[model samples]
Target: MAPIVQGTGEVIVIMGVSGAGKTTIGNLLAEAAKCTFLDADDFHPDSNKEKMREGIPLSEEDRMPWLQGLCDALKERIIAGKITVLACSALRKRYREILRLSDPDHLPGRHNCSVKFVLLNVPVEVLSDRVNNRLANGEHFMPPSLLQSQLELLEIDVSEGILQVDATQNPSVIVKTIGDSLIQTKASESY
Candidate 1:
């Protein structure tokens, strides 16, 4: 596959609710783009993981610090001139804004950092099945019971310039859709 972005310092965030194949697609995308891959779940605090493991939904307060940490990590990669692909369940608009790496209050003048978010739009039934399967296989910590909470928290705004891809499609097809969208975005911006 051709490089998705021409240069380093680009961050692609593969976002969705749990079991939406964010990690799977993120790894593939990072390999295809020849960049780094960071799984947001790896950065989650133990407390957050415990809450989710117990099937208790986390509040915004439980997520702010985690989001900030991810933002910082992404910023660090950008400053180092390294491309990074992150898998994050950025369920809310505000959460995504935090991950954009351009918050003036925190990192001033870092607006030059290019961050794109691709939302994996999977049906609730598919998500539930995936989550249950992962749980049965002991592949993840999150309990299947929290899927509804995550679905409730999900908010996709058309104005956010997020690229929504069908998660039900083959992983390669989904990655290609995201890549094509990025190429088009770059092409349009050049004009």
Candidate 2:
């Protein structure tokens, strides 16, 4: 089956705490949707990566530029007419707002671009196990010790236009659920 095509100017953010399979699921979602996949990690500065490696949670000041960079990249893709999927640990509502808003200096009329967030909800035990395994395998820079800090900062509000899914499910199944929901959402919005 063809992947569900997102509406024009829409950017999808696969968001959750660490070990919620953001990268894995985001890549699959982008591939299925025939869009570009962007990992928020790639946009992080060396200092941010080092802090995370040392098990330090970043302060909002440390994250501001990183969020702005992601925002710029999303804006570029949107202006170029490409659907982009980003995997990010947008753990707080304020952080998500930063992503959704365009830098007024750069794009004056594009405040709060169309963004859909997919929050991957997983049990704490499962999330811990995943983090431990990922660290053991040296798959990512985020240390397992920082997972608690991330969860503590996570804000899951329904008003944020989030589609919550069980992260423990098969990746394909999860992707299908997101795709189906997007389709229905778009269909309703058209009416």
Candidate 3:
């Protein structure tokens, strides 16, 4: 790994459809930021995992508790002033909003740490191939059959503080791009 890039209290959510390299890229970004890496999938209940393993797409009702748990976990770290990289599907704007607005009572911008989203943009073919490979190796819980559903749910807008990157790029290159982008954005914000 290259020298770690120093970072402030920031929560970076690596997001996209299944097989978009969210976990791989998020881990690398966490390493570059010298912070902890978290996989949102880990927070999923056994039932949720089973649903995905069975090629079932989770409904919004099935996701609320899970999303809330992730929000609480992020709040815990942010309040402690720790930087973190989390890989979450967060396919809908409401989901991302849940991840963003840590405290309902307080203004969105007054959170202890900033939440930035990184969307991995990959072609459908490439995503399918990656998911297939992972399934073939018994390395992932998400069934390749659900990729289309995830893609359908994905709502992206780079204008909304979501940094978009090519998922087909090397992990190192992806990490560097996200790191540089965050640094540049933060610098400009301070101006």
Q: Estimate the overall C-alpha local distance difference test score of candidate 3.
A: 0.84
Local lDDT at 69 for model 1: 93
Model 1 poorest ten-residue lDDT run: 102-111
Query: What would the per-residue lDDT of candidate 1 be over residues 1-191, giving only the tens digit for each residue?
Result: 56865445778899999999999999999898887899999999999999999999998898999999988888887777778889999999888878875322344323333777899999999999999999999999999999999999999888777889999999999988888888778788778
Estimate the TM-score of every prediction: 0.92, 0.92, 0.91
Candidate 2 residue 38 Cα shift, in angstroms, is 0.2
CA lDDT of each prediction against the hidden true structure: 0.86, 0.85, 0.84
By lDDT, who's the top model here?
A: 1
TM-score of 1: 0.92
Using lDDT as the yardstick, the better of models 2 and 3 is: 2
Model 3, 141-172: lDDT tens digits are 98889999998888875546688899898889
